[model samples]
Target: MSMTSDIYKTIAKKSPESLFKDRGSKFIGQAHPVKEEAEIERILTELKNKHSKASHICYAWQLGKNYEHYRANDDGEPNNSAGLPIYGQLQSFEVTQILVTVIRYYGGTNLGVGGLIQAYKTAAQLALESANIKTKVITEALQIDFEYALLHTVMRIIKEEQISVTSQKMELSCSITLAIRKKDLNSIKKRFDAVFGLTVITENF
Candidate 1:
């Protein structure tokens, strides 16, 4: 699909980590896919707890297909030395919905501001490169309910449109949750709306 056609780039299924050392300081960087700010906080908390003795924990993250939200934190490093460089690496890779955290262990030597920037940048780059990166379609979840008689029609539209059914419940009345690519969602919704007995119960982005 074209770049503008309902698609986004994100890390594959797994997170990756890397380590870098400059002078005597050790930098450990890890990359993880975060679908929400809550996940970001949780991951950061976990990392901080895991490396509680580290000198600093710095991070950068971008969210949304359009990169609607992003932040970088130096974590006591000299100004932009730790975070901005890490964020720049993410931009270079063109990946969103990801967070990268770098933990430092002060190895009894201070790698000046420039040295810190390079070390963090290189560490984040290594983590990202070691990760499995992939592109995915931007999708929205939709919950649909319909009478049993309209099941055939609904299923046919879903098949023709290639919508992924995330969950379903079949009974006297039926319900199905679908993951529909953003570009195809409106068209598919219109199709289901035309069927009198079909009802769209909830839509989640």
Candidate 2:
């Protein structure tokens, strides 16, 4: 699929895990759906505390439905041996808004750089394979404001456009927060703009 396409794929939820072993070394892989950058640290902290004895914790994450933001960390493993391999799986699946972490317990025998890369890649793949994935379309959050007199017209447009309203405040004035799928954003914006004396503002959630 085109990287700039309106639709994308991502894990439906967090908590999928997989395990891999090589030369007595253990690698535990986990996949999580992340909504924001700060969430990455929260997840890593929990995993590190839980696996206090692990020799290394490596991970990769892609943020944004379009897979625009990403990161990979090797956590002291040989350069490129652990993190890049894990990131390769995420890219291969063409998925985003997710994070994958692999925790390794060292075996007495050292697996050379190639071996480490393979093990990490395989572990990440297995974790992703175990996840329930879903397709998502690009969407933008919008806030609409209008006087009470225009409520009926606004509601009609909302229904016709099939916008997902997140919150609404209807006092003397009306304010609504909703999400507009990318495909419908322009058309919806035009329709709302035509409403007399109404105001529409777009923002990211």
Candidate 3:
């Protein structure tokens, strides 16, 4: 079956040095979920605030199939050189919901149109390397409740396995909500059955 949404993360960043010494560049890449519009604006604000003194701040963001729906400001650099290069890099990597901004502090010398393009591209490449990428997998939600004594055992297994517990309560009994893949159900069931010597309850996510 085709899932409506798939989670993804940045794995590695790519930035290479340029012989164009007259130009200096900086790259900042961050992963974001497309759940809300405010999230994008907030990140952009943070970038601007961080590099308030830079000569120019050029950026691009990908949110959905309509990628061209984004805007980039060359700030003051020659026309398309600054922002487009950064956007090109994102397209090459097939990334989305990511905003990359390149801050440039002009060296006394000027990098004409070609040089400016290389400089901005180089900056975005550097930021790309700093991110870690990951792919999300679908899993079911399982809830478990056990006495304090047995809670430790359950937690231990959870920590050691691929399952991730999303919530929990620890008063007389520890009630936990965990996320697990369907394929691993039998194995987890066996382990729990052996440890607690009983069955547990589960709920759909």
Candidate 4:
């Protein structure tokens, strides 16, 4: 997707756990759809508690509509063996606002770096493949202020354009907040601007 595009891909929900085994070691993988950085810690804490006996809990996450933010953690595994390979799956799938974690259970065998990479990558791939992927559009909030007399005109435009009214205050002077798709902002803004007595302001999310 283009840098300017407002469309993005993300998992719809938490994926069912996936398992991979190599050299007697077990790797458990899961994918989660997360919106904010704060959610990551809570998820990790829960996973750590659930699999307290696991050897390593490696993970990777990508956030933002442009996929501008990301993190990868190898836990106690060798360097890039675990985390980087898992992260590669996120890029390969072109998904953002998601996290993939791999839990390892030592089976009395040491799979060197190469084996670890393959194991983690395969586990993460399986988790994602079982997930429900979805496409989403980034949206911006817009505030419109106009006199009550112009309410009908505004409502007409809103209905015709299929704009979502997030909130509205009806009085002599009325105010409304609209959720607009980022891609359609310019054209929609221009249409509202043409209304003689209407004022439109973009609100920062």
Task: Give the alpha-carbon lDDT of every model.
Answer: 0.87, 0.90, 0.63, 0.94
Ranked candidates (TM-score, high to low)? 4, 2, 1, 3
lDDT by residue for model 1 over 1-205, one digit each (tens)?
A: 2346677778855455688998889999888998899999998899889998999999999898867789999999999999999999998888888998889999998888889989999999998888888887778888889888888888998888888899999998999999988877788888888888888854756
TM-scores across all candidates? 0.80, 0.85, 0.52, 0.92
Per-residue alpha-carbon lDDT of candidate 4 for residues 92-197, written as tens digits (9 for 90 to 100): 9989999999999999988899999999999999999999999888899989999999999999989998999999999999999999999889899999999999
Cα TM-score of candidate 1: 0.80
Order of quality (lDDT)? 4, 2, 1, 3
Clashing pairs in 4: none
Candidate 3, superposed: residue stretches over 4 Å from native? 1-36, 65-69, 137-205
Top candidate when judged by lDDT against the true structure: 4
Q: Locate the minimum summed-lDDT window of 10 residues in model 4.
A: 1-10
> How do the residues 1-205 of candidate 2 rate in per-residue lDDT, one tens digit apiece?
4776889889878855788999999999989999898999999999999999999999999998777899999999999999999999998988899999999999989999999999999999999999887888788888899899988999998888778999999999889998988777888899999888888898865
Q: How many residue pairs clash in each candidate?
A: 0, 0, 10, 0
Query: Which candidate would rank higher by TM-score, 3 or 4?
Result: 4
> What does the lDDT read for residue 111 in candidate 1?
86
Candidate 1 accuracy as lDDT: 0.87
Query: Which residue runs does candidate 2 get wrong by more than 4 Å?
Result: 1-3
Question: Between 1 and 2, whose TM-score is larger?
Answer: 2
